[model samples]
Target: MLNLNRNSHVPWISAFLLIISYSIANGVYLTIERVTYYPIFKSDFTSILLTIIAASFMTFYNYKRYVYLIPLSLLSFLLTSITPLILLLPIAYELRKISSIVGISLLITSSSMLSWVFLRLIANVNTYFSLPLMLITAGVPVLIPIVWFIGIFFLFMPNKKGNKDSISLNPLIPFILTLLVSLLPYLPYINPYKFPETVDFKYYYSWLLHPQFDGWFFYTRPFYLILLYLLSLIFKPYPVAFYEFVFLSVFYVYSGYKLASALDRSIASLAALLASVSPMLITFLYSGLEANLFSISLMFLSMYYLIKKEKITLAIILSLLSMLSHIYAWAQISTAIILYYVFRFMVSKIKPSKYEVIYLSSSLPFIFTGLLLIFMGIFPVPMSLANYNDLIYQIAVGSWGSSNMLLFFIITMLGNRFMKNLLGFIYAISVLGTLVIQPATNLIIDLPLFIPAAYALRYIRKDIAILLIINLVLWGIYMSINSVPKIH
Candidate 1:
């Protein structure tokens, strides 16, 4: 497992790091603000409540099963905070250094590494002298983003060896491949000089960068906005390109790999390899379609659990997450799951079993949410005939460009193949419908096309598939690098 000795008190990560940090900062800040004027909280209700809940959970969880514990981020915070005190240097100087590009990178990386190490060091806390230290560097506003990165990093490195209830990360091939594949596109966009490349992207960067979450932006897509809001705090001084790398890194590892495993477990790696390099995937990853990206990520993950496995509860929860991400994608995901049920029923000529009925019932809330959105006249993207042909072009060829015509031809040829698995067929059909439902969402071909394309690849001769991988990877890299024309 991730435990160091299985007796440590500091849960894998310093569970209370975020809440405790916020409590320290916001508690003091709010008290001053209240004396100045009462606009928000009378006390630190927000942070306190979260802190209490997190503290309670950690307390209860560590009671019976103490995983190797280390105050992963806490130790780094000690180094960041206490060192200056010991050396008799002012902490403000250290804080200034800590916020630099190198400093921020170190904090982020240290949190991730220490989280892994802390989970590893879960046991033998007495040996380390267990203080359950969850301190921050007094006034660092970087805690939220640090915690966010550490949360996602846990997925990047899962505990392969676990107890009976522990997750099975078997067949690590797809998981690892998908992580690399999903990460490939955003590398080129990370240049400091490059702007967000689109007007919408610029607006989103601004909207989330602000401390206040004003506007209907959050109302429409709370999931993506909250994530972007946290990221905005981290990458505010930098270009939006940096934001894309972090956002996509956390999102697509689950989406891409799970989508592959959902379709066909044996060929999951090949599926991820194919899906990650899709022209559409590469294109939209840079298009500033935050809600779409997050929705599709959840959609793919939900699909993974439901398709090959029978994790109804998880599928339902993730489907709801997708709904919160984007109504259109949720609509597609809900219907796809329901239709998969119908497909099974049709083939068997029998009614759905009890749990299957429960699964179907999960779509009711989504339907209501979708209808509520319509009645409220809060359409996310205005439906128009204008984006139809453009959507098709984007799905097949990715953006308007003559350079990828060869890639276009190949994707189309491969996309035409029929999926062998029924769920794969249903998902492909569901995503195919997105081409017409909304213009922008059609750009999300990675979740839909990744698996079927991989299935089609299986039909090819081994030598040809190898050639196709190389060819696709080169084009994928090319597409990624040239995705958004760099603004000087």
Candidate 2:
């Protein structure tokens, strides 16, 4: 058993770190075992138990005592090297000894060195999504868990006195930094000048030039392509699609900044800067998920404006456009809104505001018109809805490919619990709804991950946040460059 004081921030950080350690390990374990069928929630619960025991052993710093966990740890071998932050474990531990600017500079220096080593030895061959060192690789094997798990705690345990956010009064400093840092990781990925040969891109390109997508009804979504078509009259479809990725990438960070600024102006830019280089946006950009990007960005903006409460009209319009843009976004937004509203009502006994009622009411006519169009054969119904009987008989499986977002999701979900305000509830709902709709798959969960990362930054001093984001960016660069396309 572990010594859990049940006081202060340990419980919350523990919950978050538990997810971080377990998910990385468990995801890898399943991959190594190559199991076809496993209980999702049950296995996750087991990991939680195992992780608690592991963390207890490390917190006590007893090597002889931790020897017992080795057998169990070896059984879960795949989680050895998680994020680059794990690689920084020994260095972060040393931060306890040297807490000066020069010491932190040395930390940054060491981070770069490790990143280069990884790129040369591990990332060059592209063996796995995480660090390549396995459990039995070399040296003291138990030391792997000790250093990595303890480092997870050390990353958050910043010195209390210097913990205030040190964001510049001028927002441009952070904005320019975010842009520059954001640009670095994306440089290698700029290889595809235009859309390459892929199954979906072909139809998307044709739809931009043609008036009717006659056979693509079941699989095609027209509104986003229609927007591209109008844009293409002036520019080429490829360029239009290309720039949309760029616009949404920046906008994703901006939305987080706006939402974060509303809560804590001090760390808003820090949050935005961190969000800028996260893996989700880059992964989607390279995979060419333009509609998903557009709709999700709008949905986040809608969430942001709704929280502002003064821009209700803009919120409604963006919400409507989110539905128009993609079915997946609609599923995500609608599910999240309903749950969020219910939580607010249950907690405060408050009903939806006037603008909220109006927003829901306005969507009705558009919804009816679309259904009526489908009924009249003007537009075909989705294949899933049309072929419900066949779908109902088949097994439903959930998949997640962007291994880059794994750590981001872990941090976001747990950090959200510390938030008791609007940003907390909405994005927490966003995280939950994402899992409900598509698992923690980074499908609808990408933009939502940024807020909590930024939100978590509010507690840390400026210097520490910079250190964290730098380490994260270095990790993200390795992941993005070595990544594969999410969709075929």
Candidate 3:
């Protein structure tokens, strides 16, 4: 059995430290406006050294449990937040424990160092920015909570549990079909060239070279990238990509089924399958942000299990795992929980904690800053906001966002979807659209409004899945459009 007493608070403590370090190293304060450039502590290598010392202390002190490594990895994220930080200390510490640790560390360190160095040395070396990229990097984290709150408020509407349901046996076929169709973008095409060195595959290669790759780009952290790489290896060729997509879709379906089952037992697996393979799920799977999909599904599943079993520890574990997938996942999952209680509190006329709002809003700056750093590399790409605005305009009109708007409108009129739900969806669509407004105005005035608006929208749509889908479609259009020109 796990030693709960010995490491009861370790997880939360680690989570807190991870949040703090992440905020400091990659907060939104750095990204949107470029208020600063140089790191408070320059060489990232030393950060690694310090992180190692810190993790080592925790490991030695908490010998019975591996939870020490949790905070340690969180700290490591801080160390490698800016530049390529040598990870000898982390590597050594991991080696002493798990065998897979060394390989994972190597993959992580090498991918990051090589990517950054390649960006600096090979791709476009000699370019330098006047100030730090803090403002832009900070925007994403800041924006996450804003949007999450909006979703929570929306989801907090009137709904009671239904009757129980039975699970179906043959639900996998449609799930697989829906997933395969969603992955049409990543397939290889026939090349006219003998070596296939050159072809009219403009759409295929353009996104790979988008100049604004970092602005709202997915796969920023090396861990995420490595996950993609390993998933690629395990599943490989192009069809394997379908596996991750299908599996996550399956999880989402199961979660939805379990949820409906709680209310009405006769619920057909079709209900779950439909929810799982919706346009939203397909969109997220294609965008390369698996964590959002995973977390949302887990959060719902956690809620279902929590209600069924009423076990706090299990719920906490599920919640923490969701957080581990992506910090934003924590915000959405936690906000949903709070909103659920808030609704009940309102109904019961119970006093609520004032600090809840404050705590949830705190992580915004950090997520934004992290995103900014990933995009445009060391900050300040050659392209201006005006250039990006035009790009967004072109892509928006021709592709995903507009397409979603049409679909949404159609569903609203024909499907009998609730206006509140429509509002929630629109709010989500707008927050993502906020990315295009980057070059048009200064963030000081705009960010304040945008942040709250995101929250407001989230309040209107507690379903993270809905928000994630809108965002994914936005990302796909951006990538597909941006990548198109490069293939030539």
Candidate 4:
């Protein structure tokens, strides 16, 4: 449907070539490492060869039908590294249509592969200047795939007339009403002592009640802890919990408002309504999980600035703050920021100005704090976490019961006809990647689903809103019935 010129295809072709170059380079390095340094694999070679043959056939079949080949190939890669060659199938397809959706998907896949490589490189490095080497090595894997994907996405994007009032919102009445309604479900479970008594509260509360700055504090969410500590100073435990609840709820509503405004006022109202009643958000609020609340709110706000305002400095600062609130937010916020800049640079030729640089530079203290936490062995590595299968199951059907919402969000996103549709696809793919690659922090994927769902509401507002209200009421009742016992 989009009008395009002959030269538009060049960028996709170039991206395909870049991906090929990286693949070849990685293949060579892996081969040399296996052959010269690592032990010679006799039996494993048979498995690897068989995997290659199987993956090649699968890739060919999927490519012929114009279906996505990366997921199966990615699964195979997990089992045997040789299957990474299947990545070529999707890249080859992108050369034909050059859809931003496809480009974002490839970006996710390549980024995952690069992150794996970086982790391996860091693990293997054992020298006097390993720290500097590790830092430098970290940038390469991220930058290469990022630039390639950004190029394809930007080059092929449709050149439409810009809407000057895109960022404007309608009256605040509807948003306020939505916020009030969203607070209704939590009203029944508002026992401050009981609400904050859930998991992780005790650990965080301990840090708040008795402040200790020296040595390595394994809990790196200092902002959250400090806020809780300040709240504790003025109020009893129950009131402190109540105030925290109100603060997070307001921020969540505000984020939805801003995000929706970027598209339209009606859409913004719908987004705020959804956020107020979202089962996942409500659950976290009831449980007093400041990290999850703050991270999701800040992530949403960061995306608003990046996409709507083109305020790179605010985006970066909020993103870093979100990362500080919870390490789990790093992947979600980072991916969104990267895509935002890629779109901005491509569509508007906008780059970060000196003011943006000055603002971002302000985050150095927080970055240093994170680095210190890492140095003191405060943060746990992926290997130290729960097994992948367990984490995957938890994400799929555990406390974060977002599987149904994720399914609905994906269906709505795919059905919508908008530029933001690509973003929905990106988030959907990231959700899958989070499940398979880094299941430890799976809930972060919920943040991106909001945008598409908000957009979809514009089409089927009445029907969807009715269904959402029914579901919200049922979920609220469920939460109230199964509420945690209050702490003495």
Candidate 5:
């Protein structure tokens, strides 16, 4: 129950005050806690403060574009800081604020902050440093959600504008060549069968427990994994880890082509290629997060269907499948549905029907699952619900070695050009989050995929490709520094 209605600036100012107050309060508490008891955590206030500033800048930049969300975002951020016991109580309050930028911003910002703080507190670390503090504090809770907010906004932002897209496919061969070269790294690394000592390798290797079970059992849809495994047979019978990367890259490329075709062919092709080579996709080359690969592809495919055929039911089904594939897929699913509804409402000149609303509600079950897992901690498997900090250890090398990641994060967070492109912003933030939470290689692979998919933004934003390449190069540097043998 934070109030912003008195005036537009009131909530924003209030939020700023709240954050400053909380930071000081939290810092003082930490100092006292340490002095009283051999404090379990040493606060890295330098890193924490830096992360907050960076994250605040990123969030502020994005929220400024849709200024209405600031109050809600600020409110949500404060609420999340309160104990988790009141999580449900705040739901109704947030619901009343939903349509405005304030509500959506609050939702996104609060979720990010809550997730960040939870990871920090639950990890039971002896010291709090800038890296983890910024990561969970600003990066996860605020920046990522801000990106999500922009994406959702773009999808539904009432295209009150029109355009004539005539960027013909110039030099298709060159485009394909660039895409192939960019993606060449994903081709199976010459076999060393043993999992490389990177962060997410073990999480994926867990699947080796049922290597013969077919990843299809992992989810209801088998087409994605099945198709990838079969294609790998044509090459060498590599581990599904390699195949997941290959298939996701190809599918991401094709999906971008399909989505971009709605705008321009060359742009779509470039976007597709960028997606194929992005850090996110590259990381998947080794992480074996097949579900992420599969579901994202399906989400884009569903968008293609919705735009082209107006196949609402089919689109809904695909979206649901995408949601089921992974918790992360929720952002994509929500963005797509929101865009579809907004488009139909505007173009068809009709209010949303009951069915339209119901169809959109399909995403709720997944949301519920996430909430249950996050708040109640009623997870199905203890391993699946392993504290998010585990991702730090599992994906350590790819993320950064303390200083490296923090530095890279500072440079990227402050300088990432894609921040202007809402989708690119989200992708950029996501890559950082993934680096912190998952294995380094997995993040490396997955970054490219998410970048291109983000282009589904209705506006033909060229910055998407530019920013993606920047992230890609940064990731390459990270890998080169690691001196992990390049299996090429």
Candidate 6:
């Protein structure tokens, strides 16, 4: 049994020291790995001295507060070496019992680090596993965070009969906070040639120089290209990238706020923050992949209006715009529309409203375009040969990969039963589609997961929701650090 005091500083201090020790060990390991040739004393002495100091302070200050830290610190310093963060997970789990805030924070940090390390390990392993084993290995990182999150919820935030009044806060605060936190990790990478390595930018740049008006432009999203062209007029490439980054960030936060507002104002803010700090979203933003960001922002915004049954026209317009932004967006928006109507028919037992009809009808043009492409035999344009092993490797990375779709389905089914039956149907289909198709870049396809998650957050305690948000931020940070820059 451990101390379970929310107000106590002892557990917080212990957790902080554990993080510090892990950081020191990781820094030393990275230094050793980076240096081609390292002097023994320079590497060994520095790491050993720092590790001892960190471990000694941790032991002296609050050894009784968390006895597990003793072995964790020693093993982190001596055994795990480069992967000390994984050793802090048990400490985080224990801390949750004492202080939910510190406990969940450390839990997210450790879990995210473990995900990164595991993904790297999978990539390095030359041997292959059977499909089932590969699926399990890929799912480990994605599933661990969800499992731990559920464990924390049940352990600390047991559901009670009476519901507490939701907290009231101006939505702008979250929007601003999200913008600040979302910008922090990518601040250093902002420049005129920001993410110049991405091949997609070439198309935008070329479209800016010469406007294309032919029907052949179907493959290229005209609206996104036009926006890039306009931005290019006033700013250089880097500034254009920054402007798009800011634009997309604002919308991302706004979408979260809109979706969350359906349940509670405070929850809306937290959802916005979580969505803004999402690792998948952040990774795309930093890479200057504005097409997907724009598409996703519109998707969320449309979903918000669709859920509230307000401003149906605006939702329809936004849905269309999202479709025009990217082919991926088109697929996601189309799927969402089909799902929304099907869910309504099967679960709600109510006829579709006129507004819903309008929304469904609006998708026709995009659908027709897709069909026309296929009929003309111009769809699925041939590309360089794709390696199935590499595709499996990407899925195994657990960074918003295919495994997440399955996890999201489980989460949907467990969190809200009605929602599980409703959104769960859509999620199941999406996951199956992802498995069969396994598109090269599939993050945008996972947008549907956030809908059920937002509903789940509404029902949970506020503190628990905040814990989830913190976890999202930590996950985003890890992805940003480990992400490979796009090659042109």
> lDDT winner among the candidates?
6
What TM-score fits each model? 0.54, 0.61, 0.36, 0.52, 0.43, 0.59
Q: Which parts of model 2 have CA positions greater than 4 angstroms off?
A: 1-110, 113-162, 166-203, 211-221, 360-401, 426-447, 461-463, 479-488
Candidate with better lDDT, 1 vs 2:
2
User: Which digits, one per residue and each the tens of the lDDT, describe model 1 over residues 54-110?
Assistant: 333344445343212123223323343222222212111222211123233324433
Task: Look at candidate 6 and give me any clashing residue pairs.
Answer: 192-238
Best by TM-score: 2
Query: Which run of 10 residues does model 2 get worst, by summed lDDT?
Result: 133-142
The predicted structure with the larger TM-score, 3 or 6, is 6
lDDT of 5 by residue, 244-332 (tens): 44445566667656755544454565455444434344344433456666777777676566545566788788877676665455453
By summed lDDT, the worst window of 10 consecutive residues in model 1 runs over 29-38
So what's the TM-score on candidate 4? 0.52
Tell me the tens digit of each residue's lDDT in model 4 across 1-488: 22222334433533333333332333211111111111122233443444443334434444454234435544543544334334444445444433453344334433443444334344532122211111112111323222222323432345333222322235464356445533432443343333442345665667666677543343556666666667788785555654465567678778877876766555676566556555455456434566767777887777676556477777777877777677545544455444554576788798756654443455545555654654465764343433544653443334433221322333234223454433544454454444334343344334544544555444433433344333443333233323334333
lDDT of 3 at 78: 44
Off by over 4 Å in 3: 1-170, 183-243, 265-268, 307-312, 350-399, 402-488
lDDT (0 to 1) per candidate: 0.46, 0.48, 0.36, 0.46, 0.40, 0.49
What lDDT tens digits, residue by residue, belong to model 6 across residues 6-90? 4354445554544443333333111111111111112334444444444444445456654455555555335534323443454
Order the candidates by TM-score, highest first — what do you get?
2, 6, 1, 4, 5, 3
Candidate 3 worst ten-residue window by lDDT: 441-450
Q: State the lDDT of candidate 3 residue by residue for 1-488, as single tens digits.
A: 33334433333333223323333444322110101222332334544444444444445446555445535455564445522122222323332222332233324433443343334333533122201121112212322323233443544454333211222336564355444444333334211121111121221123323323233333322233345455555655243333454466667766766654543334334344445334344334324345566666666566565545455566556655555455444443454445544565687775535433333234334435534653546433233433443432322221222112222221222121112332233334333433444422111111112112222222232332233333323322222212211223
- Which should have the higher TM-score, number 2 or number 6? 2
